[model samples]
Target chain A: MDATFRAMLEHGYNDLSIADIADEFEMSKSSLYYHYDSKDDLLVSFLSFASDRFEEDVLTAPTGDPMTDLEHVVEKLLPLELDEERRAIQTVMSELRSQAVTNAAFREQFTDIDDLLVAHLRVVVERGIEDGSFREVDSTRVAEHVVATLNGARVARATTNRTGAPAAVRVSLASYLDTVLRGRR
Target chain B: MDATFRAMLEHGYNDLSIADIADEFEMSKSSLYYHYDSKDDLLVSFLSFASDRFEEDVLTAPTGDPMTDLEHVVEKLLPLELDEERRAIQTVMSELRSQAVTNAAFREQFTDIDDLLVAHLRVVVERGIEDGSFREVDSTRVAEHVVATLNGARVARATTNRTGAPAAVRVSLASYLDTVLRGRR
Candidate 1:
């Protein structure tokens, strides 16, 4: 999985083949084929690993408040702390998003990941609603917006005109919470 | 421009090539070259045309109640009745957005189109603020969100994913505006 991720990140997902992955670890193509039938299997494996990492981060985050919890989700999405491996995960995830949109086979898994993220978001919002820390807002809608904002930030960071990275999303997220939550941190 | 737009919509920007556009219109390569220098130029022309269509809809829209007027702007983003051509334009737009993140050349032209879209949103938000139709919000930030959501919706529509279409965005837009406005629309 580590080797699969490294190659995908450095060269985009579409650009790699099974031989390339085997060659990276100095393994025969036949040897690599024993582990995974196809490139799609490799992609699915990488997504599973990545998804586990994201879930772990969400589960363990120290969110002081609902807003901070929301911020924590944003933090994970941004890929803020990075090495080549992290970059590859993010890049590969991006390609997966595009692929998911087009492939029904992948949609279920893509949605599963999206559901987890949204559920994580809903947890914070629901807690805020219960604690009177957040305004009376549709938690799902707000959660979707928050998710979209983070996704949107990925696109924003990609643009050459942008000065910063995903940190730009933090500013947008702050304003979004302020408007919807109305000053309850 | 039309041929390239159609090609990009059906096939993603990365999937199509300079020769594809030339073959579509039955024009010799050199003859097509007479009108435009490169593929990027052709892509830019399509963007400029889309920009014009957007401006025509928003700028010429009725300026009655700001909310009502803004609804018109929102409608422009939503494809009320999508013809084959309109869907093609939308698909191409999505491809542009996906690539703009990584390609400097695409980024430059995309930035111009983004500015125009943001300007339109800023005007509506400014009008809302002035008329007390919306709470005082950060106009630039809100404008950016509007653009982000618009782009996001375009992706959803192009994508085969069951969710994240322009229609979903329209539904979300209403709630999103309500969430942020903090006042009567």
Candidate 2:
């Protein structure tokens, strides 16, 4: 998986080939082929692997406080500062996402990832509502809004290098939480 | 520009070339080359052309009502039902947007388009505030939020074929406008 990530970063999604992945691999080409039939197969597997890691890292260990947990998720997804490696990952992910328009396999993976993110967010919102930190709004709707905003901010930042988008969204979302979600408080 | 759009819909952004565009053109390849040096140049010009059309169609002829105009902008951007041709166009645009992650020229064009959309939205929001149709919120922030949601919805709908995302977002945005932006009303 690391080799695949490195190869994608080096060659990009369009130029990346099985040979490239093999070259980056410590194992033989046959061994690599034994695991995945094609580049797309390998990439699909990589997406699943990455998704699992994201789930484990971001969703599983939620903070006790619902608001803090929500903030943590947002911060992880749309960090104001991205290192070089993170930026490359984002670029690669964006490239792969574009393929979802034409590729069903890629689309399925992305959809699953999005669903996971949204479901996690919904859980957090529900928790907040139960704990009296948030108002009695539609938790699912709130989750969707947060996910959409984060995704939009990430897309804008990645494609246009809009350095201020993430920060601006953070402030806007903070205000939204204060006014709408936290209204009961 | 029509030929470019047609060719893009046919071959998509990655597989599209000058030859493909020329094939779609009524004129000779020589004439096509007379105007643009490369496919990238042609695509950048097409982006500008599309932006102009968008501005004229969606922004120029406002309904003289700020709230209505704002809804028009959102509806045009995140239309719930996409025809076959519109779906193809969205796919092509999504493909091109992926390129913006790496291609500086594409990035610049997209940045300009985003700026235009956001600026237009900001103006409508400011007008709404002046007319007391909307609350005295930060117009720029509201505009940014609206654009981000629309962009995100488009991306989600195109990539995942999450057919309901656009409608859901439309509902969410309406509620947001009611609670936050239309608080004054």
By TM-score, the best candidate is 2
lDDT (C-alpha) at residue B90 in model 1:
64
Q: What is the CAPRI rating of model 1's predicted complex?
A: acceptable
CAPRI quality of model 2: medium
Q: In candidate 2, list every pair of residues with a backbone clash.
A: none
Per-prediction TM-score, please?
A: 0.81, 0.96
State model 1's lDDT: 0.67
> DockQ (Cα-based) per candidate?
0.38, 0.72
- Looking at model 1, the pairs that clash are A9-A88, B156-B164
| Weakest ten-residue segment in model 2 chain B by summed lDDT | B176-185
lDDT of 1 by residue, B46-163 (tens): 7778778767756566566767766776776666466876665565676565556456777776677667777777788888898888889877777777666665555445553435
Q: Write the per-residue lDDT of candidate 1 for residues A119-161, one digit (tens) a residue.
A: 7887888888888888877777777666666666666655436
lDDT of 2 by residue, B84-174 (tens): 8778778878888888988999999888888898899889888888887877888878878887878888889978856666777788888
